[model samples]
Target: LGFALTCQYLAARCAFGYGTDLRAAVFRHIQTLSQTELDKLGSSTLINRITNDVTASQSGVNMFIRLASRAPFLVVGAIVMALLIDWQLSLIFLIIAPIVGFLLYFVMHRTIPMYGANQKRLDRIARRTGENLDGVRVIRAFARQKQEDERFAEDCAELERSMLAAGRISAVLNPLTFLILNLGIVAVLWFGGGHVDTGRLSQGDLTAFANYMTQILLAMVQLANLIQILTKAQASSLRIAEVLETKSSMQDGTETPDTASEEAICFEHVTFGYPGAGDPALEDISFTLQKGQTLGLIGGTGSGKSTLAALITRSYDPTEGNVRVFGKDVRSYKGTALHRCIGTVPQKAVLFTGTIAENLRWADEHADEQTIREALETAQAAEFVDAMQYGLETHLVQGGRNLSGGQKQRLTIARALAGKPAMLILDDSMSALDYATDAALRKALAERQGMTTVVISQRATSLMHADLILVLEDGRCVGQGTHSELLETCEVYREIYEASAK
Candidate 1:
């Protein structure tokens, strides 16, 4: 009993280690993937693969370690012992074994595909759950709680049906194996009784033969359970392997960037399209911004303003032309080296559950308190942050849900500023703020010497004061020049400016 306990404990420990290593490896591989790959896989499905699938594989490893050797050994040893006692009666073993083997094989073959389909259904359920949680506020505002509930229920029902179908098939293995083994035992007794009556077999030998048959039945039951676990594990492992085998389309470069270059950014006739997209998101986009200058990007909805920013950050490579940063081709610089010089506040304000100071440190881990204060001031967020009871120590809920929209945007901007990047990209991040606050933030940004800024906005007034402005229409550069020059030379710019004036 002590030996058995020790073995079980060791098996659990091994399984835990295997799970930990597998999760870590998958997470590291995911980090290497480009944004295109991430979009293709979907975050919900990736979460399921790392968590639920890994757990299933771990359970299989634990069960295999405990019962893999012992179950088969017991069955084979019992069969050999019965043959030693009475070789003539043991002929029944051949017939029973073939039937039991066929049954297990048929069940396993039928259930493996079902198990794979069930896992995919599980991924769909996970996706639905994530969407509901993330969009809870929108659902409430639209008064669609009943609609969401019905959708979630539908997914759950499908998962239940699939699971039950697979379970029913797996359930048949044990009972059928036992029934065949029991029938084999009765045959042994009948045949052995005649042998005993003829003085060829003893009563004690017959009793031993019956006991061996019982042992084979019990062992087969254990073997059946192990097969069920292994089948599921096989399915889960294939999913895990799919992720591990996917190579990142983007390769990291070896060269570091030249931080002191005068040219901040340059796009040379660049054209880019998302994977599987029909048309290019950005077409023939060419522009250049010198160091410490403010460049504004004004575009209509779906005009590819954010897509241009992603190219500068090397999130996706251009399909046709080159994007250069700090006087070097973007593809030539190491990813970390390039990102270290650029700070970006995306359109969506994202925050984690932590103190305000912790979130700021995400940009620069060693940023001092004074630097944090300066960032908040530049973002026009210092007043509200200081008014909070804990000030910088105030803990934020997930995604900063406790704060209002404008407040979250300000904090995200401050977080980007804490790094003191050479180039800053604000992708419509100021849309939540009022006009007065937006003006104040722009004034603050202008005063920061030696920092290049790219402001993307739909509001024409936001870019009127910029040194250079580019008006985009349908992924094409329709106008390029200072605000006043564009108003004079470009009809598209004149129309946009006239409309915003009202």
Candidate 2:
């Protein structure tokens, strides 16, 4: 009944919504992670913490409650029974006590650290495996499957070696304990025989004395097992605590800014680095976009375009300087207020397995069907969606595999637009669309939307009509102005324009 009630409480408290909220908290904690910390281990190790480490901790807690609650009563009961039988024979148990205690102590001290190290290694293996799985299509296409297989095999082997070593060491503990215990029993027999021969101990007394010796050792063995379990649990608890206790470097500010501004977005002398990076990904960058203005950003890959977007979204904080939205530091307007105002379509369009309407609803769950359809129309996705058998209700496979690349991009755009955000960021979202489709989408946005927009693109055609164009080279802004001005004054912009034109 106690076990059932305990399970019921856990089940009720850890139901789907509760578990999801907890996992989200844990997930967010992992996101603002430092490269140094993540690099020190692997994804597999983190998974172990979320899975095996947690299990070990719960098992240890259960073991502790069971053994600690019962051991004292059993020990006291056995001691009293032994004294009633023959007090002298009970003295034989003292000879073997220290040996068992020392063995348990030895396992306790050494095994805890080993378990910790082993969990770390398991995380490494998980990280490697997760990376390979996510990139399996690329691996196969590039004929690198064999290489990945070798890498995965090596990780698996390392995990096996660590587990085997720990298991082998722990294996010796139980048997050695019993061996010393049986030796103590042998000594009792040898000593008890003399007592029996001298007529000092009765037959029932001798029989009961033997039973008492067995019970005491069994009780000690249980205690030893409990110690071993507790040690492992302690190690695991420390690891989980480390993650749960870590403060996100990008904590939201306590104060919120209610004052809106004409400047929709601003980056003021921003400098940022990944955790522990020697050089900043972005340095002393500054820019501003007025309400309803379209700002075009062009740069080479890794020139910090995505990092800029992440900073704008407040996914991370600048090491020095500030990113402001609505004329207030973004840190101040966090949680729902800031995010609801910005719509971002990442470089890769990710779609969950759901109906088209459901996916769009993520942008605004309260949005009606008319709002969903209008957003789709603005994205130039209404035509395709209407052609489908289920229209907005059509089920999508994982990652929107049922749709073509352009369709997925349009769907993502529609989803972003459904929120009717104050600011819109399209991070190379048009890459998968054809030139004609891209032009159509741009035209539709120009005619329909009044929000501030930032478009990151490699193609010159995508930004030819922007109010302002910022050209980046090697992480520095090389040119900033209208397209016509850039073409006339900026050599790099001219070169990029000519190359794309050709």
Relative to the true structure, how large is the alpha-carbon lDDT of every model?
Answer: 0.91, 0.80
> Lowest summed lDDT over 10 consecutive residues: which window, candidate 1?
66-75
lDDT of 1: 0.91
RMSD of 1: 1.7
Tens digit per residue, CA lDDT, model 2, 275-377: 7567778888888888788889887877887788878877777888988877888888655667788899999999999998999999899999889988999
Q: Residues 1-502, candidate 1, lDDT per residue (tens digit)?
A: 9878987999999999999999999999989888988888888878989998899999999999888757878888998999899887888988988898898888889888888889898898888888889898999999999999998899889989989999999998888888888888889888889999999988999999999999988888887888899889888888888888888788899898776899989999999999888999999999899999999998789999999999999999999999999899999988888888899999999999999999999989999999999999999999999999999999999999899999999999999999999999999999999989999999999999999999998788888789889988889999999998998998988887888779
Error of 1 at 28 (Å): 1.5
Report the error of model 1 at residue 328, Å: 1.2
Candidate achieving the largest lDDT: 1
Error of 2 at 422 (Å): 0.9
Cα error, residue 229 of model 1, in Å, equals 1.5
Model 1 residue 399 distance off true place after TM-score fit, in angstroms:
0.8
